[model samples]
Target chain A: MAAIYSLYIINKSGGLIFYKDYGSKGRMDTNDSLRVASLWHSMHAISQQLSPTTGCSGIELLEADTFDLHCFQSLTGTKFFVVCEPGTQHMEALLKIIYELYTDYVLKNPFYEMEMPIRCELFDINLTQAIQKDRVALSGR
Target chain B: MQFFGGSEISPSPPTPTTAGNNAHMMYVFNRNGVCLLYREWNRPLHTLNPQQDHKLMFGLLFSLKSLTAKMDPTSAEKGNLGVPQLPGQGCSFHCFRTNTYKLSFMETPSGIKFILVTNPRTGDLRETLKYIYNLYVEYVAKNPLYTPGTPIRCELFNTALDQYVRSIA
Candidate 1:
């Protein structure tokens, strides 16, 4: 079944705080991934500037030929993005779920530092299990 | 406090007077964590002693770099996701932004770190920092009397930096 290729959560400062790759695979290096995250950050800022309205906004969806990218920004400016196949359904729901998981497991954890990359074992486990469940559900459909 | 709208700034320990000063402050640090040069204009931070503030800033950058390195998915042992990957030991990020202020950072290959504090509206300063690095090499490094790891005090370098910063501000 078609599924999410990967997920990336970038802090407001353009650092990759969290990342997870589901079954789908790729070989992008660390530096390349960092560059990609930063590029999205700059592009997000540029897009907001180029917008006709002068309100708080960001890139919610970016549809490409091979893959579909969905982005969600929290009120605090941190961004969460997911990469899935072009025809994937309800990816936004998955991004929302990730945000919720991040808030519950990462933010509430006393060990976590603000604005730093995420490094919580529970957060990682819960996120992986949740994604696995979603994949199973998608295949069962 | 966080909007990217036009920001009017005061020059040199942040003062009451409103003027243009994109390059509000500059700091230089060696690989050993020693501060080589610390310059500020209209500095808003007077409560924290200069020494304490510099130490805190350097600490912040060091910890942040370590954290970024650890979070990188492709750094090492990608096959195993359960272990803590904090020993990866490298990070590549340009700047970090807060609501009111933005801190731009540049690290030289030789391990010297240059940190610039500016308003959120300031443009990208990668080239500007490279130019400043050149100026440092020309004046400070070449001066026969100047010793390494000491505070930078080249009059020519200061004058050039002043003119350049004011132009951007």
Candidate 2:
């Protein structure tokens, strides 16, 4: 089975900037995705505040019975997260690669606005390619 | 012979205290979002008032449960997002980990929720949470004076809980 089910990217201010589903059985509408993204952002921040020690970076992984959610927050506070089947390996590496793709195709595009919904066609095409590559590598292994 | 005796009797190398102070805090909330118990062992920060803190924690759990249910891949019925779900109705999360801490959650069939915040490096705590539920059942649930849905104030329960948490932490 493909490891990743879906992906979401949230802007620094807790706005859902992008969302894509990679053949997940449970598909969410746009409004639902938006709500989920902002809710996750709040939960992440609250987790940081609820930390007993200093330097906590917020929630990075959530493990459910059937799936796992892995999140990576950039230095600029943008968050990238993937929901995948339970016990999927190499998710952190995949998220980092997605971040790189975002930087290259979306951020570098002169027409792309900062902290806004990602509408870059190049980004969409490259993200698909990257995800497909990962899927193929998994199947080969 | 003397060296061998010393080695054998040296308290087994102090048993390696590598698991130092793993638990940070815990919350026990009954159904209807009432926090029945709150305990802290190593928390160094308190940003919100106790009431507000409990409310936020409960809210987080509520939203997360619904979200997980709505996103269940194996289930055909997709419930409305953000709606409350009955216990055991959804694919509930066991825990979440951040850089600093891990939050392990459990909900009993009776709708009692248990949340344990621990060190991020702590391993899977599913069994530990089950043990904690057992503790609750023994101490508070069976106590004649204890009232359900109220803040837990039983001294025996608190003592037993502290001792158990310390042992595991």
Candidate 3:
């Protein structure tokens, strides 16, 4: 069964707020993942400028030979990056749930600062459970 | 928020009467979730309250869209069920399809939903829905008297919709 490689979230300032590698090997080191997040942030901006339509909604999907990368940017500018197996179903739902969790676990925390790294244990646990449940459901098992 | 013009929404539930089943029942909901225009032709049963039923229908579509997007193996373009009839789209299953009723739904970018319920044998109504949308845009949207996010009460729109629905019915 295809699996999620990693998930990264970058705040509006292009700082990596949340990162996780669901795979055992944890494909890339922390430095590489941070670079990847910042690079994607610039790429997303460049793509928007290159868009012919002024009302373009921005990049939604990135397809590669090995994996499918889905990016969902909320209205508030917090972007959720998900790298998963190709042909994953209900990706939009996943992004939405993640955003909701961020609002609840990260943003709602009084000690949490806006646009900072997500360090909430509740967020971590909920995200893991949500991803596992979604993976299981996707496998139709 | 502006369900019916700028005035405050009535505290009472929108119970605008019941629907008649005459092989054709069409509902036009504004973006504010108000049942602006509900035209029924040959409707027989009044078992369900009209306003309550409209709310329920809207809620059902909401859930159906989420479920369809969740089931879609390739979900792009704002959670559209590009490949429809997935396992989760059905709402009331098992006993839901005892008759020959077909429900076709189309949503415009502006968030207005057009629902047409007809015979199960009815052909694809996507194009027909588009045509109806055009009529709505021209007659209702363009009308200065017709406020946005409010029930559509334009005479021309109602007449045109009635004619179009009759021709297709």
Interface RMSD values, listed in order for every candidate: 13.2, 8.3, 19.2
Which lDDT tens digits does candidate 1 get at residues A1-141? 448777889999999887766644435567756766776676566434322122425456554334556777776889998877666887767777888889899999998999898999998898988788888888888
Better of 1 and 3 by TM-score: 1
The alpha-carbon deviation from the true structure for residue B119 of candidate 2, after best TM-score superposition, in angstroms, is 0.2
Model 1 chain A: ten consecutive residues of lowest lDDT: A47-56
Show pairs that collide, candidate 3.
Answer: B20-B43, B21-B42, B21-B43, B21-B44, B22-B42, B22-B43
TM-score of every candidate's chain A: 0.93, 0.96, 0.94
The best-first sequence of candidates by lDDT reads 2, 1, 3
Q: Write the per-residue lDDT of candidate 2 for residues A35-138, one digit (tens) a residue.
A: 88998898888877776676777888999988999998887899999999888888888888898899999999999999999999988998999999988888
* Candidate 1, superposed: residue stretches over 4 Å from native: A1-141, B1-19, B77-89
Worst 10 residues of 3 chain A by lDDT: A48-57
Task: Report, in order, each candidate's fnat.
Answer: 0.00, 0.69, 0.00
Docking class of 1: incorrect
Tens digits of per-residue lDDT, candidate 3, B1-169, equal: 1421211321211212323222357777765568877887644444457876787666555543442233222322323222343333322111011022445677776667887766444566778889999999899889988778777778998898887777773
Per-prediction TM-score, please?
0.52, 0.90, 0.46
Better of 1 and 3 by lDDT: 1
Shift in Å, residue B31, candidate 1:
0.9
Order of the predicted models by TM-score, top scorer first: 2, 1, 3
Identify the runs in model 3 with alpha carbons over 4 angstroms from their true place. A24-26, B1-169
Docking class of 2: acceptable
- Model 2: lDDT to the true structure: 0.84
- Model 2 clash pairs are none
